[model samples]
Target chain A: MALDIPSPAALQLTASPAAVSAALTTTQVRVTSSFRGARIVLYGAVFDPSTTPSDVVVIVRGPDLPVRIARKTKVAGVWVNSRPVVFRGAPGFYMTASTRPLADIAGFGTLRRLGAGIDHLAINAPLEQHTETRYGVRDVVVSRLGADYLDWRRAVVRLKENAGLYDADDKGVTFVDKDLFKAEIDLPTEAPTGRYQAEIILFQDGQPVSRKVRSLTVEKAGIERTLYLFAHRSPWLYGLVSMALALGAGWAASLAFRRN
Target chain B: MDLYLPIAEVSVNAPLLVALGALVGFISGLFGIGGGFLMTPVLVLMGIPPAVAVASMANHVAASSTSSVISYTRKRAVDFRMGGVLAAGGVAGAIVGVEVFRWLRLMGQADLVVALSYLVFLGVIGGLMLVESLQSILRRRSGQPPKPRKDRRPPWLYSLPLKMRFPRSRLYISVIPPVLLGVFVGVLSAVMGVGGGFVLVPAMVYILRMPAGVVVGTSLFQIIITTSLTGVLQAGRNQTVDIVLATLLLVGGVLGAQLGAKASSRFRAEELRALLALIVLLVGLRMGLGLFFTPDEPFILMTGMG
Candidate 1:
């Protein structure tokens, strides 16, 4: 089913093909015993035949969770973590891919409004709303600390990027023809298991004409899944079982070595 | 072959992990000490998270120590009464240690504290052992009689109450020393993610005046209990113990310990102590250097701590 909506720009927006406007090659990611990483291919066709697709940007984001970014400073001849910034809702995994450079496709204001890039993500600290305290940073008012806030935010992005959980690739998306485009997204081995959302935005004349969002489930499967569930669900039992296994293994090893 | 760790949530090479376990196990067997000090660092270097590395290494230590304990028991080398008293104190220390560990983690100083403690402890213990062993070796080579050990037991140890007899170790010292020693080792085991046998062995030899033959077995018995406790607590509290990873390491470690125990009989005691001292000193030096060196990345991102 296609949804045709009129944009404020008075442009007709439609996501097609109606049956499957945007689809992921696999809706589920299974983490088995030998799982290293996985690749996801997202493909779709823009239905606005009247106007050629100027830009296609695909954004994939993993489940959001609280994250803490810390900067280390040398203290008393040892490096110690200082000045920690805690983000209340940070994506565990994020990637942005586009047909061309994002700056070349649309203006910064439009891109930020659409939340199409890392800089536009709505991540905030716990005390962001309080003007007096401003996220536990001592004596720094929120209105006066714009530059410091940007620095902390940039630090978050830089650290996450180094951790292989956040990425951006301007050349990741390619157009097969006039209307069909595809993007490849990589899920690193350390990626957290959760629901991931992929949004395909069709831009014409540097304006977003249509957008389609699809979700994929990434979860552990088989023995991996069972173990993870057991550990989280009944941690006491898991601990007991682990201890018993360790004890038994040691005993068995002793017996085996004694024979030799 | 690649194997996925359920708890750590990472895939790693199975054989490489096993090889690392074997290498550490051989050293433990040859030196009569738990190998956690070496194993934990190697696992962290192999891209495993530091928390997971510490927890899983505890499990590996428990298993390896058990195997050695069995062998030592068969040879009548273990002082069970002393081990029991030490373990009793160790359990209490481990409980307190876990709380301290949690507090340090909240303050974001867990890594720094653990690393610093490791460097200081290893440096002092390794340096002392090296000098003592070298002196003994030189005396033998020069055809001089070995110097008599001084009555170095502190005055406080003699005055403590609750004295007990340990016939196996030929000591009638107060039980307070062994118990307090166990408590100190337990704290080290929890915070530094080591079995604490490195500290225990030297303490028993120099302070408690236990026979060298009995020290190894008694230390292994205490290690088995304390590390097992640490592993269980870490699994329950932090969910950081990776069972699959521990199993791979244990498999190789058990075999290597057997070979190491066999080779232990071949080397002279002074030479073995000297070699162990060198290894400990090297590890300490490396960690100590880390404190002074500037890291390539000054920023780090952590999850599940907000």
Candidate 2:
């Protein structure tokens, strides 16, 4: 029920993905909005429509968090009290809530909640779920015909695929698969004549799985390159253009207002 | 005063900006556009890097728009058909802004062009705003309601072709002026690093004679569209948009605008214009001074980096 509500505090972002795993149906979700105000620190998370609020693990972890929040107990072979303990913050503590209690291998396996009876929760046998995360550009291959050699405007780049496991589909469907993922970098004609590098990363369950690196080269053209260097090297020319632009823009603005 | 923002580290210093959203909201609550002239320069001085400031301002304006547009819809201050026509022309002009920025950057002359435009255009705008507000103030002091520009076609604009019929402004204007205003703002945005609100808001209030009711909302709609694109592009290109930064500014701006909207009605139209005029003049002065006396340092040579 809470999933439908948009959390203003959530760091929401939207990205254009051209692949099955890349296209996020609901890219913007309430990550969480917990901030300490005056006294109490607010901790919250949205309940997926299918799951009850009690069943979800709303973990709070950082420095000085409680190790245990709840414990399961059985009396007369009839389960009664699910242990709930709130610990006072000491120093560096982190808190995590999980519906799956360890002692059994799979934690809170695949949940197929049936209308109003019971959600079929089995042992975690690789819970069929996937999340698409963004990794920085790892490596880039740039071809520039050396400064004062090749035309600066004609720089081209072929970004080869940086392989990573990405979510295929999660429309409440069975069995999610891996999808091809990559980044497309766009360059403006004004890129500086130099070398630049970027890094790429892969993540699973809020953890880094892999990483890579890449680079690019920016070179200048002939005639203009010489002219550009000459103009910039000579301080006078730079000042000249700066003043000229200031005067021109001033003139244009005046014209806009003066027309009336 | 806790004015320093956390993520951007850019303290919002303008007293007028701190009060503007509240002021505008107040008037928009009462009469309208009482203090619009102040919005642009105030945002600039706050160190929002121009583009995002305008976009954020626009988005904030949308909230105000949400409020007033409802009333304007009731009062019919907004001639729906006319606004649509202007918006259509404006979109065509807006495309030019992106190109102009790219072109200027290609020449490694973006800052130069931007600074120059600010000097030239803002001078005229600031001068006009000051003079007009002063005159209006005098007229009101002399016990006159200062009959608004009842019906006069600004000669130069009226002279152009592609005439348009705007019922609310009650004039048959040339499509050229509005479209040109749109393009001019678009190009200005690239150089100015604005979402075009600084240019367009004044154009609407002073040039087009839009009832104050429609100006903020109409301008905001455009700002939202432009800025949202800008947000995506900035994310794609620079990857410098720290969501934390944007959120901090948004948080401050949203709260500020709410207060500005409430402060609107306490001041008269002339008073608002006077404050606006003062803001523009201050920005103009700052730019003018920088022009004559730029810092004594070997300015880093900006080699073209697309």
Candidate 3:
């Protein structure tokens, strides 16, 4: 629960001299055995605020992990999973917060390129690679499955959303002062351990003027970390230990009963 | 309080998990059953991944059976020789079962297969037990002596090769039948994350014609080895066993089992069997209903399969 804010790195000055920088309340999150969930605040300031009104968009994304979406179909009398679609680089956690609606802040092309909105988010998958130019970038996401692929994509989002992993809020980013703003992102207990990225973008005139990226680490700590490493690193030994523990406990219980 | 399971990677209520373990353990002790069939499904219902629930329950079974085996050993009820043969066959079955489990997981049918297995086995076993127990209860109520069970083994059992003499059970049976029985039970243990005692005990009494005195002990002896082996393989190969979760269950199970054992003397055997049968049938029916009913969410999402 302790917050350790690391000094924010200055971003490159854009042509307009407007630079947006952000820092998380904690640069690292240690998920202990008692970890339920955590709320992290990404606070930053936009320097040299222009006379023209601008919007701030904050995105916090977890590490890419492969996910499979299996659709169930009736087989005989029981329903069973049939076709499965695998997304190779689905973010384990994704939260997007903006001062205003992303569509109103920037054009579709800009948001798609930035991957700012939930709908505009691009998840990588193994698909036929005939690319079409869209939003000044080759869109590899649109594949032979075509419109059908969107169903699978939507399934992933819906499931993640239900799990409280993927989240979006049009007005989650609040400006506390003339240039100081903060965005809160909630990390669920089921969030995967890995590196997370927080990106703060300043949009003006329907275009992103300045962007800054900050990295955060979420990892198992204390007994949780040790056990996770032991289980994965030397599973055979761990298994033996598990057997031994069971045997010992069973023997102890029997002895206790006998003594009584 | 919520505690995160390292391997399962999910936060769950610590007290709730312990209570679940205690409940399963108490039932197992009261009925002299392994309780894996009950434990696995309940864990899954509590949102533990199916694979983790199954693998971890194997470890729990190992502990519970060990407790029973120790008591049986003190009373000279266990047939170590018979248990060894069964264990050998069980180990072989477990090896094959784990591989099949892995393949099912890859095909994304592990959950379906597990549910079906539980539904079928629990249903058949529960129904048979209910009918048999009810008949016995009625006979006792009418002051009629129960019909004596036929002690004769099937002719086919004697016709098998590699016959062995088991002085403990005072039976001369073919080694092949016992070994094959062991193998079948072992596969069940591995795939279903059960102790397989429910099946093993009945098979030994009727098919092998083992003495009723040695049946429970011999089954427990086999269960300990098979479930321990299954636990190890599951942990090493599938990495599905959650040691922390296993430990919590053990703490509650050991204590609950001792209390249940103490309480068992007060209950009538026939009545207990009938109650156990009813509980089993209810769990089985619940699982079966899940299969037949349409899910609100037709899509199942899995992460970290890459």
Candidate 4:
């Protein structure tokens, strides 16, 4: 057993598996009328036996969408939304889980580069300008308003976390053995319907060795899907249908109660 | 059990929603008010988006009002001519009101304005009703004749042109007053996210001098048209109406309204008014305190903005 321990150089020299093979408890999250939330289990086995001095980090990113946050200020004895910050390309849901604490596993720069944390997400401010030159101007503005923009960005993260749409857990993943590990992601009821990407990164000595990406679909099913489609596709008809239903219900209720 | 609201994009407890509807419907039936003001705030508190809350309340009000209107009509209490005139003006006022609402929203002061307005209106109305009802109750208990309210129309109302006769109300008043009154209620309904029945009932009793028997049915008729218009416009413009939510509320609301109507006959008029006044005061005070109290979170987020 002592002789089986390879030297550090030999360990580095050996060819590792290109990527980890992973499977999800369920690939598709079907949002039925009674859906509250779901706990998805992701299990994977590191192919290389020599991948001991490594960590596994799983990142689940939901679809990107624009989000707006407003800060309330006391004005004339009342609270009102005064400053609004709009964020573009913000994920509707985001979660990161790691076998060990993210800070202990990797440096800030590495985590940022990998976009493995909520703070490291690539979100942009929607600076209103149409012209191509606006990018340069916006960059200058952002630099000048760096502190304010950072506060707004942090607020966005805080809001999403509060809403259960963004989360991170250092101990969310556990290694069953040297070769197998599992991560659990809890999807909240507010999870938007869209394509989600689950990325599993294998890290060796705070460096990425291999990575695997899996596509997951979160979709409204059954009547939920039909109603959503009807509202979005033909809003006028949807409105009329809603009105007719309301009227019919009212009439029926009146008739039913008349006898009593 | 939990049910998902498609437009609101939130899952809520089904029984809780139904109970909320029942409570508000009972209040509406007892008071002859649409209960939108109460319902909207409650929905917002339940984590539903404000826009969705307001739009769906309109749908619920339309249904509830329709049911009440049918009952009132069967009893020959509705003055159709008066309702028609008010509804016509309401339509035009609602158009103008929508524009005003948009303008206020652009300035980001809509929420403040709505809250302040509700506080003021509810406070004043509730206070007045409380005092009058209490006095009436005391007078009746003491075996004294209740003082009669002055029924004389204002001079300005008499001088106005386009006079019309409301045979059921037994009034020959200027149509302009009712139309203008309708416009005022319409604007309030649009801006306040209510059916304006609380305001309408008082206005009809005092300003238009409509008989108490005719007020509930007539106001309900107007509410049906006005709130239905609001529901359609909200759906068309904002796409905020959640039919699933509205349906749940309507189911509970219709049944609750019937039961409340039955219960109303059992209570004395003054006692009913006093109870309603207490509820209004409580709601108003809660809203007023919200304005002064520091919020747990000074920052709020509005998602899905493009």
Rank order (by TM-score, best first): 3, 1, 4, 2
The C-alpha stretches of model 2 lying farther than 4 A from their native spots are: A1-260, B1-76, B144-150, B154-164, B195-198, B205-217, B225-242, B301-306
Clashes of each: 0, 46, 0, 0
Among these predictions, the greatest lDDT belongs to 3
Model 4 Cα lDDT, one tens digit per residue, A65-86: 7786677878787777865566
**In model 2 chain A, which range of ten residues has the least summed lDDT?**
A156-165
Candidate 4 residue A105 C-alpha distance from true site, Å: 1.2
Standalone chain B TM-score for every prediction? 0.96, 0.70, 0.96, 0.96
lDDT of 1 at B160: 82
Clashing pairs in 1: none
Which one wins by DockQ: 1 or 3? Answer: 3
TM-score of chain A of 3: 0.86
Q: Arrange candidates by DockQ, highest first: which order? A: 3, 1, 4, 2
> Which stretches of candidate 1 lie above 4 Å from their native place?
A1-20, A51-53, A133-147, B151-153
Model 2 chain B poorest 10 in a row by lDDT: B297-306
| Weakest lDDT window of 10 consecutive positions for candidate 4 chain B | B297-306
lDDT of 4 at A8: 30
Q: Report per-candidate DockQ.
A: 0.65, 0.01, 0.68, 0.56
Q: How large a fraction of the reference contact set does each model reproduce?
A: 0.73, 0.00, 0.77, 0.68
Question: In candidate 1 chain A, where is summed lDDT lowest over 10 consecutive residues?
Answer: A1-10
